[model samples]
Target: MGNETNEFDRVTMFGADWCRDCRRSKALLDSLGVDYEYVDVEADLSAADRAEAISGRKNIPVVVLPNGKHFVEPSDAELRGELEAAGVL
Candidate 1:
């Protein structure tokens, strides 16, 4: 788990199991020991809508940060940059 004092204490990742980028992002978070809530868009249709609303696009792997910022289908480097910017790195 990540630091509780940081803004990334608990993030929300909106994605589907079948998505490659989602899996990669999840792996990155896990490797970084980041605490996050995984929301399966396939299991819950509303999650897809929520992801779209947050990112303003129909893309999976939407990572919702604790500070209300979000990343949609971000690469590992992008994720790292965001985490670092948020003081989670």
Candidate 2:
């Protein structure tokens, strides 16, 4: 985990450990030294509902940004751009 600048500095990722994309996204975040809160949808069923509330779909690797924006199963490039835009990269 990285520094916590404020309440909104947290990056919330909703996905299960078995998900490949989730692992990839987490790796990217870790590589870039970004702190994130990983919500395992499988471990806690209620987390799936939270993911649906944010994404409007049942998609693994739903990444919720600090500003409440999200990317659903984004590519590496897409995730990179988001990290750059957030000043994390």
Each candidate's TM vs. the true structure? 0.85, 0.85
Model 2: per-residue Cα lDDT at residue 10: 76
Q: lDDT tens string, model 1, 1-89?
A: 12223334468899888999999999999999988899999999898887787778897888877766788888899898888787666
Considering summed lDDT, which 10 consecutive residues are worst modelled in model 1? 1-10
Q: Highest lDDT, which number? A: 1
Which segments of candidate 2 are over 4 A away from where they belong? 1-9
Clashing pairs in 2: none
Positional deviation of residue 24's Cα in model 1 after best superposition, in angstroms: 0.3
Clashing pairs in 1: none
Q: What's the TM for model 2?
A: 0.85
